[model samples]
Target: MGDSVTSRALALLGAFDGENRSLCLTELARRAGIPLATAHRLVGELHRWGALAREPGGDYVIGRRIWQLGLLAPVQSGLTQAASPFLHDLYGTTLATVHLAVRDGLEVLYVERLAGHVSVPVVSRVGSRLPMHATGVGKVLLAYAPEEVRLEVLQNLTRITAYTVTQPARLLDQLRRVRAEGYATTGEEMSLGACSVAVPVRNGETVVAALGMVVPDLRRQLPRLVSALQVAAHGISRTLAGPASVEWK
Candidate 1:
């Protein structure tokens, strides 16, 4: 791409992720590889457009406009709307961190999150990008993702933790199990002491997103957690229509 200010500004937003959700002007400039002046100009425009908001501490965080814009994205909007009420109910019942995620290339994009009151504190926040093989939701989305998409994730493999599935053959088997069981579960695979169960929300035959809940302990919580996840997933699946779905036979 040519060296354009617009391109650079977009790149700056891309630099923010779950781990680095907020950044000062200097940090944003350095991360975006632009000069301070250029960063400031772009950031000012973004602020005006409501894409970035200035915090009291003076760092910039993704603003409500970005969140609203994400809602306008067809797939994300449909999936999230269909899942929100059900997710809210799940949160009320389970008191765990509930997340709705979609596959974004080789990463899992958390599109929605409802923090459950007594649930395990998860690293996931809305718009967070997490490794596909590590988290339950990511794994569930990957499991039903097209074959080429699966290959792409495997190609970008990183061993995030001892429990992260790195062996391609093993991971493939796990995906198969996820497909059969209609949900996926992991015990501290992504974060130590946190367990999660996820189910795919299919629009007809094609899986569009994954909904999950994180629990502090897994030893005695599998049955109820899995049940809630399945119910939420099914609710979202039933609400989807149009061309992006599969006719599950």
Candidate 2:
């Protein structure tokens, strides 16, 4: 009974994600696969414990406590902090939406982001996990990932947009180029109007993260964006390799 209650509570929490940030009681119960009565009881307990909050419209959202706990994560506390300055500098130079991301199993988890003045349609947010095959940062990380992981991801190439790389052979070719050229680029793959370029961030020889930038178009400024991303990525790598790197663990 205790275990069942715990799983149900966890399921309720898991119902919220980058896309589903808020939900009413019925929606939460439906998504969580629990009875409405059970959802109500669990949600009330969670709300009292500060694990969830009710908005003015009465929809439930992840509470401040969840965010506070997320900050304690190594990737969020260390990598994000180490890369914050570099991200800001890159954003200042390119005036483009910049991202710092890490491979989280089969997905790319955005750790930090700097919004640009450019009116590009950016969908990623801090703490959001996006498909690894649809974004520039995802491509870079996937290129460096293990063979089994790559195979698993390749088996499920969900098409995000018309331009997304759904063909395994083509994506494999692109991943090879990323390894050889040391960067990745995408054209309206994840979103319709946005294009992106990314480079790997390493701690010594191991790729630990990816730094990416999004713009309206990459054809005109691909080289410049790649250069800026590489510079920022290298800086982050150096910081992670230094004595301050202990924070990352």
Full-model lDDT, candidate 1: 0.84
Q: Report the lDDT tens digits of candidate 1 across residue range 34-77.
A: 98998999999999999999999999999999988876897565
TM-score of each prediction: 0.81, 0.87
Considering every candidate listed, which one attains the maximal lDDT? 2
**Which segments of model 2 are wrong by more than 4 Å?**
1-3, 57-59, 245-249
Tell me how far the alpha carbon of residue 211 in candidate 1 is from the true structure, in angstroms, after superposition. 1.5
